[model samples]
Target chain A: MSSWRKLAVAAIAAACIPAALGFAADKGPLRLGTTPTAAQVEGWAIAVRPDGQGLPAGSGSVKDGDELYANVCASCHGTFGEGVGRYPRIAGEGKLTGDRPEQTVQTYWPYATTLFDYINRAMPFPSPHVLPPDQVYAVTAYVLNLNSLVDDDFVADRNTLPKVKMPNREGFNWIDPRPDTHDAACMSNCRPAADVKVSQTAEGKTLTPRTTGPLDTAMPQ
Target chain B: MAEQPKEQLRTAPSSDRRRLLRTGMGAGVAAFAVAASGRARADDPSPPADPDWSQSLGPGIGDRVYGNPSHFEKDVIRRNVPWLTANAESSISFTPLQYQQGIITPSSVFFERYHAGRPTVDPAQHRLMVHGMVDRPLLFTMDDIKRFPSESRIHFIECPANGGMEWRAPQLNSLQYTHGMIGCAEWTGVKLSTIFAQTGLKPGAKWVLAEGADGAHMARSIPLDKMLDDVLLVYAQNGEALRPEQGYPVRLVVPGWQGNVNIKWIRRLQIGDEPWYTREETSKYTELMADGKARGFTWPIYAKSVITFPCPEMPAKGPGIYEIRGLAWSGLGKVKQVDVSLDGGINWTTARLHGPILPKALTKFTMEWRWDGSPALLQSRAMDETGFVQPTLTELRAVRGTNAIYNNNSIQTWQVKPDGSVFNVQLA
Candidate 1:
């Protein structure tokens, strides 16, 4: 073959090799094809933010909420939301800090809208959505009243629901100390020689040390 | 001795000799002799032997169309907390993994965690509504869903918080309680993409909110990219209508995602431009890290494997040769390999994986070990197709901190004592 022709063929082969490899890499992992349209994806969006971004438009009164709560929620949630067994108690509980603290709506929940959104979406035990929008509003009002967050006559419609501030609203904070550090306290200082007297095991039986000699070899003379 | 008796018999009458010999024997021998003589007196007699119970019962019928687990498994049933939540209206139950063998948790024995108890929905009346960011909003009936081309894949559905009890301390005694919240089944359903194709997708659609028909109206927002990737509107599990506990008429089978996102008793699919901050996506499934920052939208369950046998409850019968068996799974992809460590994490031996190692399915793995009855900590680690290795407890804690109660797929260790007692232990 001619030298020029050979050179051309080799150059062409080199170019084709990379293109073939790129195609194979692009094929990548076996994946399911895309089918869901962008519009169909939007209908199910229902997240509510602490800043009230996704709060729906609705309202209810604390008095009506109390009546709805008695009929639907009191059975399992206890008369005053003390909770029974696995069901969480939602009222009259303080911050879940200190010893023997209770985690309830009054103590733990950061946003009042969370209760409204949760109850509206999944509440009242059996036959969900059996209650209309107004009843859900009333139930939220009643739950808030039970928690002592709102007055008995306060209305809890969507507009008023977001306005009701929870006691533990400032309880949760975004405190991410990136790159954590742990240091041994013994590294810096040691007790005085007279104060560092070793004690023998009880009954004059000494425990076998897991390691030989002193734990730290470096010491100030 | 026999010759002297014969000579005496000859000296006396034959009948008298015989009586004398019988009297010389003990009373018991004489009674046996009498019985023998009586039997001899009869015309014919048969030898005695044990009776056959099967012959009396007769041969059993053969060949059944559908089979149940052995009659011995009558005690194995899905048990629920009677008053843990609500009565039948809303409740949760657990699968009896202690009584189960092999990796596949029977559909009947599969655990159920329902916000509202199981809902009884007629298949005919069941409708799946798909609306939102789409060119056309379409509602599909059960029959309409069946008309589409269906794909059957063996996948595992696991609750993200399966090991929630062990987040702070080793609270559960058995692996069944700590890791029983998972089950594998051959799911047959139409791909969510196929349905998505029917309604042309809009440009900005990024998420899909799935809702259930149960009393809780359980809902979760799934990323649109994930739905387009590998999601199924599963109608059948293990070749039958999903067990009532799973999802009777239909359920969204999100492969490798948390069990909660696989919405059971599904009735709606709303597509949107952004995540619908549903209670499930924000308040419930969110993980509050030790750093105080909540980790939200953490969907994919990482690679996790556990040694089921020789666990805390079921210890090794004795030292000798034994089979160390367990299950390994990855929600992100297929489980590539599982390595078993006998001496904490010092030395790892590859376990023999069995069955089809399908993507997002529970792959059963086993290994043979000769226990010397010495104190040892055993654990298993899994690697997935994406090159992600199962992290150790310390490694996981280093990243996510100690406060989160979700996605804890760290290697679990079981400490075995000389007296055949196994206890849950953490590797230092």
Candidate 2:
């Protein structure tokens, strides 16, 4: 018999042997785990991409989102999404290139679906992934509305979320234009003496929080 | 060790006895012994009932269920700047770089960054589900994952926000705060390709979504090319099961990449044709460029180095002849060379790099400097095997501005004063 014919016969036998047996054939020496069903896959795969992929069937209006935001998010993220304490500010617009850029869903986020995705996955600060899909859409809509990206009564569903154009949609690219800064390994006399200056000092700054005791207090003095 | 305050020394019981002895014997052997004992008493609060620990019967085996660092090494610890974040649960802590001796960071002092807090996961209950665009979907338990062929490699895991605090200005006043958001470890795990081979990939599968089992379910989409390259499904670090904060049950170790992509408490990996553009990729880790345009998927950490000795926390005593030591690492490959500068960027000298320079791991570098107690600016620059030289703070800010807030691997400068105190400084 030809070599190709023998390989085809072996392939047929390999496929038939699995059907002949009652279980799925092991690919390696260790028959490690069971094959998961589609239902099991859906239960754990919850990430929603920029193209609205993996979104569950749900919808929420901006009015409902405002109410939800007040109850669950207002403490950490302020009533106006100004952000309290170290929580991120979620509502701002048009200062991406400024000295103090107020990066928010409106100003810096490249896609609207990210708001929905982030809210669905991790939100409410104290609790995460507790809100149902509808509330996630509503909260996303409310945050966007605060930045004037959507109407107060705007409804966000899978179809509408992706279609809603974000202000910075065209602002991002995947190209890495790095190795951007270059410093030569010059041994001596690399630059003129007059060009050097100490631009900043952290003299009186209190950066780290004071711990209860010094880290080295337990060590020998 | 810091010097004891004069007030503290005066109040100490041993010092009181020593003062009496010195008064009795004005200037002689008794006075010298009293002074020597005073210094020793200051270091050890307890009076020496016995000579030393070697003579005493220390606790035998199994006295400690798990071993700990010696009592004298209590200063080596993971420290956090509490005000940097909203709360402890969603914050970052730095490695004690000044105290670390070699390339591999001890499991205890490794820096930690978490979106949510570290989860206490039971290994037996943990399961990793692999599905989507595969010939067969598989759900493997932790025990089953260990059955696969395994390999051990030493690599560095660094947060792109390592030197981010210095972007706006020289804000943090210590080397640990400036360059300690990183740690190197000997990771033991099964190669990602081994798992991929078992669950055969379908045609057109190009991306893999790695999702963690933490509260945030932290997720990132890694390209298939990277998965096939050097990524490992790690279960152990530094010869022991991973610590809870380091992703105990299981984690993905993406060698040579930034830390965020190496998701901890990893539970699911879904193969797909396109990237998942997760929230981390879009809102958090993306580098905001100077021209209002943001750059996504800026994954690899560049070459970076910083002088650990004579830093803000470990200033020189008198500065005669001291060996300046530091760590240099590169994601692309092993570090080729490191240059030490005593007078800012005007002059540089090649530092001697220590042995066992593994790829993608921290390489130790040292240089002997003779200081005349003069005020000087000290800096260290690293060059990776790729011939990529580390950049200066001025050079980096010229291109990236102060807003990127991530991937700041610029050379750090420490200003040494005439009094031998070192301060974190930014020179332009």
Candidate 3:
């Protein structure tokens, strides 16, 4: 039998024992999940959106963020938010137009709330989800200051966050305009041989090691 | 380039080729087949020999509680492009697609993407909290979750940036590097809707913030409609407990969506009215368009297919009625049909779909091919049940431009030379 079938049989057997022992068997939708207190919710539920809905009641200044960023984020994100080794540059370039566009906070991101949410949840590379709300706010402010979106002393909080307009605020479209190419299921003579051109070629990098051998090699001769 | 391969190809009928696959022959046997085909071909073996029976059966059964792949399959592993990330913790790895067979990808080498690296979580201590807009905020232990109605379904989790590296140019060399950010497996778990029904979602609960228990606390705002659709709070992958690299105790499996949104080490699910606009959704997964504008919430992976054989890694071994195999899939729905092109996009022929072609799962396809030892641009075009055919590289670039890194599910091409060598190439 399949493993899932075995698991289902085992689960049924486990559930029956409770009723057989004359214990109060759980009812209604398996009766799983314990009602958690407000304190329990406070331990992990932290997420901020574009509308500043989840922004905590805390204030932070870009000036304070600059010092904190240097002490914590500079090693990986670079002192100027220029980025070090592919760690994502928070500033410098803006609004990708060139062939190789640098997708930084100042240029690409449509919302400032994303900055606050990311830093609080996943940041600093080595350690994450440890930053207090104020530090996250300060860093968000500092990143915005670097992007020239806000002044250095600008304090960001729940109310002030939604009001801060991003440069690419209106730079996003909704509908997925796909099935763009109208290449029919042409069976034969679709394109001329001369028309076909080799546009790009592989870098020839040996990314994956080749597997070609017996399981066991050496033996005690 | 070699006389032996051409002569062997002329001698062997197609039935012998099918027998080779059915026997589950080792690489040496396959190598001998290739060697008999040609000396210039890959795996140029010296000669076949009888097994040294005295050396065999050294280790007894039950020696290892958890078994691993054959020692020869050491190279069949997840690999990384070192230059992609600053540290290994926040890096991603590619699945060995060319080495894989059928639909299910082995749990061990299923591509890994870690935000704060794989967390070592004790299942006993792990807890799943469902709060926010729910009528009753609930916390469920591992044991409590298993009691819910369980489901087992085969689905594929694909990273949106599967072919993102080759957006501008064909950079990677192998099939694994190009289309390895995907894995299909039978995931067994409780449906999120089943769990949410008990929580009783409040009136305007449109979205839910799925959070992870890892150090990164990785989070993504998923639509309730999607959560109710097919999303799973998975604890087991394939037939065993989930690999630590793929969220051990619990993880959210957002079927048909980008892999990132399927948060690993999932801890909390906060039902809310609006999207959280997390960094993952905004800065990372968003697609940058041509007009300097960007598009967000672009989730579903479109129709895509790639030639597994004759790929850079596994080139045509002096081609003789070879079973040209590959994988075809679509996040939209089931793959309705797949067409193979031998001469770029000039001519097309239907390839047979193998195994159970389930929705949102990898579908294996094969075609009987007789290579004439000529330079050819080979490609596969996949069309889903939704009638959305996989776009060509040129067509994809024309619409999306080279900037949109994620969701490059275009038809991939493998240029096979007369010498039986294959190179990744883009044709116009």
Residue pairs of candidate 3 with colliding backbone atoms: B5-B37
Residue A130 error, candidate 3, Å: 3.1
lDDT of 3 by residue, A138-174 (tens): 9889988988889877998998888888777777765
Instruction: Put down candidate 2 lDDT per residue, B238-350, tens digits, no spaces.
Output: 99999888998899998878999999999999999888788899888988877888888878888888898878878888959999999999887889999999988888999
TM-score of chain B of 3: 0.88
- Using alpha carbons, what is the TM-score of model 1? 0.72
Residues B1-428, model 1: lDDT tens digits: 56465455433334633564455533443444344343322343653232222112222334346667854456555543232233545544556555656656788778788777778989988778787777667777788888777899888888887876565556555566667788888899988767776665676777788889777778887777677666899888888888888898899998888899999999888778765556576556766655444666667777889987787657887788888888999876788888887766666788899977888888888999899899777889888776667776676777776666778888888877787777666654
In order, candidate lDDTs are 0.68, 0.81, 0.79
The deviation in Å at residue B275 for candidate 2 is 1.4
- Candidate 3, residue B412: the lDDT equals 92
Q: Which candidate is the best by lDDT?
A: 2
Query: For residues A1-221, could you state the per-residue lDDT of candidate 1 as single tens digits?
Result: 32222433553343244332122234442222233344543444444544565555666787777667778887779889998656667789553433234656666566777777688777765556567667777787888888888888988665776687877565443322321222111211223334321121111121111111222113211
Q: Output the number of the DockQ-best candidate.
A: 2
Judge the docking of candidate 3 as incorrect, acceptable, medium or high.
Answer: acceptable
- Off-target runs (Cα >4 Å) in candidate 1 are A1-58, A78-80, A92-103, A106-113, A145-154, A162-221, B1-66, B75-91, B96-103, B398-402
Query: What tens-digit string does per-residue lDDT give for candidate 3 at B1-428?
Result: 25336436543434534444354434344534433443242464743232222212234455568888865466787877666667778878888899989999999889999988899999999999999887678999999988877899999999999999888888878888789999999999998867866777676667889999888888888777677667899999998999999999889888777899999988999988888878887778888877777788877788899999878878777847788899999887788999999999898999999979998899999998988888888999998877778888788878878898899998898998888888888886
The candidate scoring highest on TM-score is 2
The global Cα lDDT (0 to 1) of model 3 is 0.79
